[model samples]
Target: MTEVAGSSNSNNLLLEQFKDICAVDTEIARRFLTESNWNLEAAVHLYFHANDPEAIQNDDNARNEHEIRRRNVANPRNEAPANQNAVVRRSSESQLDTWGAWFRALLALPFRLAYFSLREIFLFIYALFGGNALAITNPREDLQKFLTAIANYPNSERINWFNGTYNEVLNEAKSSVRFLLVYLHNPSHQSTETFLDKVLFNKIFSDFVRDNNIIMWGTDVRTNEGYKVATSLHELTYPCLSLICLRENRMACVLRINGMHEITPVLTALQTALAENQRFLNAILHERAQRELDNRLRREQEQEYQIALEQDRAKLNERRRLESERQDAERLAREEEENLLIKKQHLAEIRERLRAELTNELAVKGGETIRISVRFPSGAKFDKIFGVDDSLEKLFNSVLVHATCPDDFSLVSSYPRVHLQCAPDWYREFSSVEENFGGTKTFRQAGLENSLVVLVRDNDA
Candidate 1:
């Protein structure tokens, strides 16, 4: 119930505005506004242009067609019959008035030609000065020249004119979604002075226009640009006000108040028209703002998502690197342990073999026995008996069987302190040595006497 009452109040407000703007009865305004889906702007646009007084002179059949359509809506059950009757009536009217219309058009042809000639001239001028595809002259200069003629008087109230050509002002109005108030002034006409003095320069009218944010633009009809617009509008009046607004994606004439008028009526006309159409501008503003906000929000979200994705990917990669390093360390530790076990087992085998060979060599304890003492770095001593003809290899093998012997060592003589190359690889440190520098020499063959003590040195230590 509240929604319906609110809707009713809204409709009533729309009807009042439409009647005031179109200067129609309440019933007429209600009917037009309803036909236009309660859109004041569209409804007002339709009422003015459809029932244009100038249109009534040129093509009155259009008004008849509109009336028929309006009646068709009120009595929908009789629509087909009404359409048939309309078709018959139109056929009769065409047949009866064809010759008269043709003759009238023939008479109007010369006037139309003159009008078209001026229109073409203005179009060429606009192409040059109105920021066309290629502008040849400065539009600001042209507008200034036009405004200079109007502001020639000292006491004149100057309107804040748009500093551009008609084409530029139209484009601006469309872009800004504002009403373009176009005044085409004819200097020779009687109404021009009245319009300028009473309406155009009136404080109330100016204030209303300023408050409504209407773009004021004017040019003399004698000028090429203005002449072009005048011819295009087909207005015969001296002082013409063309109220143009952005409608259906194009700047179109919403209402035109022509000839002489007082300030109040002019202000009322402008106000009603603006009230009828400003909703379109508001809607456009809202839509653009909404689209911008949506785009901004989407961009922000995308940036955040990308940032989060990068952070997660970085964390995952770090974890993988740590896990890989841990696994590698564990593998290396296991390999090192296995290698140590194998080395220990190999050393035990070598010790057992060395003991067996040493026992065999020392068992022959008969001829020319030489006893040598080996002193280790840890102060451990090993006294081994070898035959005087036994090779130094027997001494090294006997030392190896002892648990205190180092894995890699060279024997040094105790009294002489000479490094004896008894080990197989001991000569590797020398650039040149005797051919029999290794363990191939026997203890007696080498100059070693009985009970010679040698020191066992560890190579790594």
Candidate 2:
């Protein structure tokens, strides 16, 4: 079941491809390809061959027969039996039509002759007045070809015509800031030749057209381009003239003159239209200029706003940078204070250990030891035995190392209140210590032995 369904889908896709290639209806393509045993090449070959003349003729004959049968079935009246009387009626009607055609032609002969005579007279008058008859008859030619033919005609150089498309002429008029005169000609019209010869070709009118900054675009109504313009502008007469100008960025017809008119009135109408539309064009230019100025001001304001925003951002970044530096400085100061406190605590522990060891050594040498009582800033007291041989500098170093505020202190004898300078190098020599405290006096003489009270005071006090 699956295989069968898949094959069916593949065949459908192939049929669509064949339809696209041949540009034929899907059903017909499928039927023909199926008849060719699903062979694409054979189906295409048969399809083209079937379009041969004899095959097409046979197909047409078959279709006609089928249409006849269908009509007979649809209308019972068409299916009626044919008779000899009906055949005779059809033959008589054919003969009557043949006679009626001949009689109508004969009756119209005089009117036809009069029409041709009038046309010939018109042509003769046109030639006498230096107009070209051939040019009038071939009005459907291209604009350039038509204009060139007119220029080659007898005395056609008297009229100065602008040679360009309608749009091209309008653009030129806009660039020069002038008005455009568009003339649509219908050469087939009876009055066309007379109007051209008498008004357009006159010396005064031609010179006026040439001297003015106005552009003139001419077209024949019979040409495709001319017909389109005429229909769009709703022109209803031959030899129509329009004065067009650019106003508010669009082409506007200021005035239109239809049918025959004298040269003086046409020129007056053109001049009036130009004057009115020129004011409108000036107003448009003024409005455009004001709008441009407003746009420039708006752009400048936006640029200033952008600059202000950038400056504010820069100031904020600088403020943040200063704040970060202050925080780092505070953090470094705190770290240094903590490290100094830890160093002082470590020195006190080492001093306590050294004091205990020196006291034990002096106690073991009983007679050779000297005992001293020391008081701390916290009012704590301890007794230590020191060898008389121990330098005074060792005693001062131990006191300083144990002091909480070691950098700001002095030691004094409580009774005399004498300040002591414990210089490390000088007091480390036994002879210096002996000279300052023991040389002039023995242990009992200077009252310096045994135990003594000492006070620690702040250096500032």
Give the winner by TM-score.
1
- Residue 266, candidate 1: Cα error in Å is 0.7
What's model 1's overall lDDT? 0.66
TM-score, cand. 1 vs. native: 0.50
Clashes of 1: 0
Cα lDDT of candidate 2 equals: 0.58
Model 1 lDDT tens row, 43-142: 7555643333332232343355345433322322222233222111101122222455355556646655665576568768877775453233454565
Q: Positional deviation of 278 in candidate 1, in angstroms?
A: 1.9
Clashes of each: 0, 0
TM-score of each: 0.50, 0.38
Please state every model's RMSD to the true fold in angstroms. 17.5, 26.5
Worst 10 residues of 1 by lDDT: 85-94
Q: Which stretches of candidate 2 lie over 4 Å from their true place?
A: 1-223, 236-238, 246-251, 258-264, 331-461
